[model samples]
Target: MEQISSFFHSIGTFIHSKHQQGVYNTVCLAILLGLPVLIFLFSFFICCHCCCCSRQRKDSSSSGPAHGKKRKKKEEDLWISAQPKLLLLEKRASLLV
Candidate 1:
């Protein structure tokens, strides 16, 4: 039992010594604390970038049709006038049937 206790004590002393003077503590602290902070900052910047891009798209689309695309009002008006005639023809054909 004494041998086992001495072995454990020596192991503990070695760990303590390493902890006090080695780079192990610094690396452990960075992994435990710095990693989470770095991840949070990265995610925040990515979210902001995505939101800005989407907002730009929404603003541009809301501004109306792109340049060089003109509205064809004359063709639209002709189609509008033809609708009633087409409806009349459909009704007459249904009556004959």
Candidate 2:
């Protein structure tokens, strides 16, 4: 029983001594202290970048076609103006079937 208790005590002492002045402890401490700072920096940059992009987009949108004429042409292209032809084609295809 005495030998077992001494063995456990020596193990505990060795673990404590090694941990107090060890590379493992130093690495763990560095990560624990640096991780939050790193995350904060990354998030700060991301938020700033997103806000800048949104602001630029909003400013461009508020400029009211001042940016270019391509958008207007694209919008015009999206409108369908041949409804009568489309209707005739549908009727003919249905009649043929």
Candidate 3:
């Protein structure tokens, strides 16, 4: 147990070598400590971006023809007029027969 603890102490001492110790090194250590937080934030943003794209696709599908009320009205009118024209053609065909 003493050997194991001393091994860890030596490793710590090696890592904290005076030549490599400074404010910049401290900041680097702090940044390394926060690396997991940075990775989580990156993944969170990627998930949000994916969700946004899926929502956009759903909105586009739901809003497709309904978005242009004027165009829908025009199509309805064309169909209404076509029915009368079709009836007239049928009547002319009956008279010829």
In order of appearance, the predictions have TM-scores of 0.44, 0.45, 0.41
User: Which residue segments of model 1 deviate by more than 4 Å?
Assistant: 1-21, 66-97
TM-score of 2: 0.45
lDDT of 2 by residue, 16-94 (tens): 7757898897677668769999999999999999999999999989977664545654465656689888888888744
| Cα RMSD to the true fold for all candidates | 15.8, 12.5, 16.3
Best by TM-score: 2
Candidate ordering by TM-score (highest first): 2, 1, 3
Which numbered prediction scores highest in lDDT against the true structure?
A: 2
TM-score of decoy 3: 0.41
Q: Which model is ahead, 1 or 2, in terms of TM-score?
A: 2
By summed lDDT, the worst window of 10 consecutive residues in model 2 runs over: 67-76
Comparison by lDDT, 1 against 3, better one: 1
Question: Model 1 Cα displacement at 88 (Å)?
Answer: 50
Q: How many residue pairs clash per model? A: 0, 0, 0
Give the runs in model 3 whose Cα sits over 4 Å from its true position: 1-21, 66-97
lDDT of 3 by residue, 14-49 (tens): 658733777777677768768999999999999999
